[model samples]
Target chain A: MRDLELNMVFDPSEVLRPSSFQDAVETLDSSDSKIVAGNTSLYSLARKGRLENIKKLVDISKLGISYIKEAESQTSEEKKILVGAGTTFQEITSSSLINGRPEYAGLKEALNKSPPQIRNVATIGGSICSAVSFYDLPIVLFALGTTLKFFSKKEGEHLITIDSFFQNPALYGKSLLIECQFSSSPNSASSFVKLCRRMSGYAVAMTAARIKLDRTSREIDDIRLVIGAMTKTPQRLNQVEEELRHKEPSIETITRMCEKSADLVHDIIPSVHASTAYKKRVLPILLREAITTAVERATER
Target chain B: MLNETRIKVRFILNGESRNIECMAADTLFDTLRDSLGTMSVKQGCDFGGCGVCSVLLDGRPVYSCLMPTWKVEGSKIETLEGLKGKELMNLDAIQQAFATNFAQQCGYCTPAMILNAKALLERNPNPSVDQIKDALSGVLCRCTGYMPIVEAVMQAAMMRRKKTQV
Candidate 1:
């Protein structure tokens, strides 16, 4: 209901500009306020006549959260790519730290598929918050097992896993996203694929798959499979992952796993654009293709 | 109840510092075209769909239609006006290339195409044909069938390369 109130103007008296990180967190303590990062999607939504009920847009684009680099994560000493909430898609697409790792190629692929102008302006944190199905990068972020870092002046910083964050987006929406980090697994191979009516159009359905085979060669040691656009949010297929993990990825086994995952997806997301029947029919194939690509990439490594 | 608050934001606009009172609702597209008379930044869809309002914000191509005017503080903005070369009568290299290559019809998308192309050529002097296509992928040309525009960018690259070599 909050998305439909229209024609309301964003008067300057309401917009708060916080100069410091701590100040931004403190300012965001107000439950009604929304954060603005790059303002791409929010601007688009307003142009499309959405967000009518919203009054205040706290501009966080300048709150000193802009960063993109590999750093030692707080919970673990392992090196992870810590992309600040304000880090633009342009930064992510071309970040040498992200591109340097073979596992992040999936993220690079998804971000690259976004139009050039969008890449130059839209921030990854904004994309994560938008959580719309057709936005391609969320699928990759989910597939990569990314974790988001949120800061509140009162609560300090909380690192929420992607799975948990999506399960309760509203709980974290008001909080400021400071960084999103993912374990950089050298042994893993990741792939992202999307089907759209037009070459540069928004995705109809997208999949991002990451596969890590055991050193012994045949067994899939770890895997993450996520699908997007069939629903309001990106959905990770845990059952499908469970079926494939710690086992040889045979053609028959992969096919069965994809079928079961596709079935499971029908119960999860109320399908759109591509009908439920269509998505159910095609999910397994796309998942197969993405996983197959990841598997091959893993074998090459 | 809309609160009437205006902030004086300063930015380098076309090589000169200009201060303007920007409201929260004002977009860069509105600020440039409405307030400052920068007609080069066209409002096509008033959203990101049409890249007609593209401008170089700090030398990177971004759709000005969506960029909040309040966000322009301390940033340098370049429109087609900034592409006016050395002399009063002279044209930018990309503009010249577009003209020589017959890259305009109604000319609505021309400014954005030129600016986005210019941003591309600045970072990548000698981009391949595919690279050129990849760079200009955002700026849409509905009238010219895109070949001439793509050729114009290639020619501009060549011209820039030639100028550097000489």
Candidate 2:
């Protein structure tokens, strides 16, 4: 390790600060460059000698992408929150557009999972591009059914769902994520629960659930459950969601379904901190807590 | 190919404007300690996990180890050194509170703790205990057990509020 550290140095040839969006795309398409925003994860990778491939570092923080605003959706009933790619977690958490609404409680919880220092600098675009499973934002955003906008060299501009983006993030390596939009509904509420060894540490098992309840029936109208830190990418509990979809979620029924969640999870990634068995045991508890909280919040709405 | 290109970045440090040349990949922690001779910015895990290198960038607390130096161009950067008043003997209210409350033991994490506290106090002068803990969550201190640090920040907040009223 010492020898590797001595040999691997993060000495990029040049750092380009593109003044315009078009200029940034041209630079990224023409050269062996990487987009740097926040530089939180990039610096960590550099310290571990994992960023040896890049030649040029393109600083994209100056491209003027930091913002948060509510936009009109195709359907007048659903409102979409548009967040700039360069917007930091702190900005997202403190934004009145997100904070004032109870439907986005899950996102607020997930963003607050990180320490203030990281929240102050780490951008949403950087987190999504990194595609690390331990990150809380991707999992919560996935449950919220977020859509990402990107500008690529080959494809001028396009929008991809959060689910598809996580499946193969490497496909869009050269592309710049411009912004992300997630819809907020009146009847829906989301919640995120993570169990870790220490405060602000990497998750042992984390779960995010978003549920919309039928107003009169009080049954589960729609649900999305995503579990992270157990796989290379965040996995959705489709089996459990299918069982709970149309049925009225009770404390007992949710508990029973989540207990069987361990069997439904496949490709459990091994961790240095927690054993596979322990994660399996803890997965159900996290799922139960997340779903219960989300259901309670949704009912209140 | 190994790139040795250097970049010149200008930013306001404390109250003064300064310019320094460094590698494009160098972190703010590196430029502060190695280049500009700001030794209070302690290097811990070098990863964002440890907040020993915490500093206020544009009045917001951020891990200096994680911030690329060039990103601070035209922004304000504050460290523990900047907390001192015009006279060397005058310490910021937060520092004075920390000294009286026994917030430091090894003193390695004190600079970061103080800076994080300063940022918190600046934003919310009357922060609750939980709020103070949340703000100080970034900086990890092996000594002090954290209670003293929390007390110091609360006391400093009171001192500031009293001073402003007077």
Candidate 3:
């Protein structure tokens, strides 16, 4: 049995302020470092001995990773939503474009469900790096097909898909997520649903859905569904999404697609959660809820 | 072995530049309450679960109890003390609302409540009841039942908006 040390405390010998992404990477390479942005979750984890090897702390709060950039939309050129990794949940929740945009309702819902204290300090970068099941950002970013930009010691600065980035072991000892970028589609609409014991912070199950309907007819065009806390990692239900695209937006279609989610999730991770049996029995209901919410937002006149 | 790591932390406390050499193991709350004599940021729970030690770190509310002192270098740190001498008892709008509405009961949680409300209103001038609830959700108040507290925040928001419009 591994003995847990409750007596351990956070002690950093040096602090680094890196001006650029490359500089941040260089700074991390110097010693055993823990990145501090909002330091909400990271500090909590440190106190709980979750971060067992952290010695030197890197403060990245000053980096411009907290801004949201909006660009003119184009086909070849996608409208960018560059969220500075240091951007807090508070910033995201208070963001005009994010909260106001119909397409981002699911993301906003997730933000709403996150803890208020965490919302104030939990950074997008830290949430991504923490890689916990309950954290809501990863699922939303995954459903949005967001790209995580990181600074690495060997590879320097690079971008990885949120889905693949979570599997990368290099994320732990070295690379740091600096920002997340998603192509903003005006036609896109999203919904996020989580089954928690209570609304404050604890999440036993969560689902995030992003759909883009046909501009003219409002038929479902592209669909993405990501569920978290039900498995070892958040999953993108590609099979169910493929089944729904180009289909008519109806209760029947949503129900069928949702039913397919149970099979899809089982294939991904057999042991889901406490409500594994019940989740499989009732997942269609929640998925349908997410779909209905998305459809209502997408079709709103 | 008790290891003492000394680091220089410079932050804007109540809009004043506070420079102090302290042990890295010390939390920002400890640095303020114990070292700098800013007890407005109370020490409660010694963990982030209790918001009694809440303060504004760069205009965002944070639990100073869990924050390591060295991590806040070059950031703005505002406590209840910062707000006391501004104008008219120097109470900020939220503080004034708390006072008028009797939002505080025991007052142990008032400082953190005010700071949390300050952070919320700074970013959002008019937060919805849900947002207001979420903003104060971290702050645990053993008094006032939170209904009057919420009402005071609402009143403060309305009053602040009227003032701005005028």
Candidate 4:
């Protein structure tokens, strides 16, 4: 079946290049119209005959949304980074603004998950909208508390939290994702860990953790723990976060909580590559590593 | 019957401007191998998983198999064909190093490996062992165990550096 799909030819009828957001939205409103950016996933899907219904291809690469800049935050105490949807993983990984910053360490690691070839063309917007469970960026972005700005014919323009967006991505179908913004706070850092059979291979289990430490108390003030590649969608381990909050971070306590949380995980999607038992066994180790690195970075800041 | 729509795509290939009409869904891999006859861009995995179809797009290495033909409009593309020397005896530094170091076995992945190394050398004149590994990690080479390829890239970087000093 896979070989047959690979041999199939994909030929679309028309390709539309929209220069403005309004024009893109209008084109997307038409039936059987789909947006193409990077063309990494779209081309593969088309070759596999998954996009047979897609007749009109709207090339949104020229929509003028490829950018990464610092935006003024609502509060003076916080700093926000706005990343255009069209920005590729390579761009994000090499950005001086994102690199060397402890707050964005997890994002940089996630962006480096893919090799140079894929990273050079795969855009962040496409990665998020695709909503593939095993993708590294979505899991890290969720832990970083990212918010998406999308445009639809009905809503015009609105912002949705990354958490909510992943919960029901189909609800925002036919909408144009403009950009994503995440706030960076002082004494905060993030880390991502993935266990793959080989380098750059699909993750059997992965975890992303972000920690915000109280400057005075040096305690874990707030934390976000997200685990992926073991389920249909990345899930947040709220119980573990609640257990660690306002407490001094230690290897023993974190290991204990993560181990307990791993046992509580149910409904794990089995894979031919990795068994459910093996994934469950390693989930706690990945969680401990991610949290440990995040805590270490937060303290260093 | 399938609806067919072809449009003219203009790009600079091998330092020469080219304009070709192709289907809306045609990938850069198809345009290069079928339309332009640049056979260096091998077609391995139609998807982006395999890097045998790698090429330099505007000085950055990308998977040509995953790039749409329309996306390369007005951009610069370079493949192994463009890196060859004018004469048969003379070869590009990377190519010469690969030949001397026995970098290739079956030679199927040589073009992509050399092209990826070329891009890395152009960006960083002197790359470390880890840097070379990171650059060539995308291209899968079943033979030679990759040590020879890494040595070849390192040697090529030195050769280029010596040439500039002279």
Which candidate gets the maximum lDDT versus the true structure? Answer: 4
lDDT of each: 0.80, 0.87, 0.76, 0.88
**Ten contiguous residues with the weakest lDDT in model 1 chain A:** A1-10
Sort the candidates on DockQ, descending order: 2, 4, 1, 3
Docking quality category of candidate 3 according to DockQ thresholds: acceptable
Q: Write the per-residue lDDT of candidate 3 for residues A1-301, one digit (tens) a residue.
A: 1011322655555566777777776666755776777766655666776655666677776677887767455475246778888887878877886877778788888877765666877777777787766777788878888888877777777888888876663555577787788886757788888886657655677788888888887889888888877777777788888899999899887887787788777743334345577657656777788888888888883
lDDT of 3 at A104: 79
Cα interface RMSD of each candidate: 5.7, 4.1, 6.5, 4.6
True contacts kept of each: 0.60, 0.73, 0.34, 0.69
| TM-score of each prediction | 0.92, 0.96, 0.85, 0.96
TM-score of chain B of 2: 0.95
**Number of the top TM-score candidate:** 4
Per-residue lDDT of A28 in model 4 = 77
Per-prediction DockQ: 0.49, 0.59, 0.30, 0.58
Residue-level error in angstroms, candidate 4, position A40: 1.2
Docking class of 4: medium
What class would a CAPRI assessor give candidate 1's docking? acceptable
Off by over 4 Å in 2: A1-8, A73-76, B86-89
lDDT of 4 by residue, B1-166 (tens): 4554678889999999998887777778888997788988897877777799999999889998888788899999999999869466899999999999999999989999999999999999999999999999899998788999999999999999999999
Give Cα distance to truth, residue B29, candidate 2, Å: 1.0
RMSD in order of candidates: 3.4, 2.3, 4.3, 2.2
Task: Count backbone clashes in candidate 2.
Answer: 0
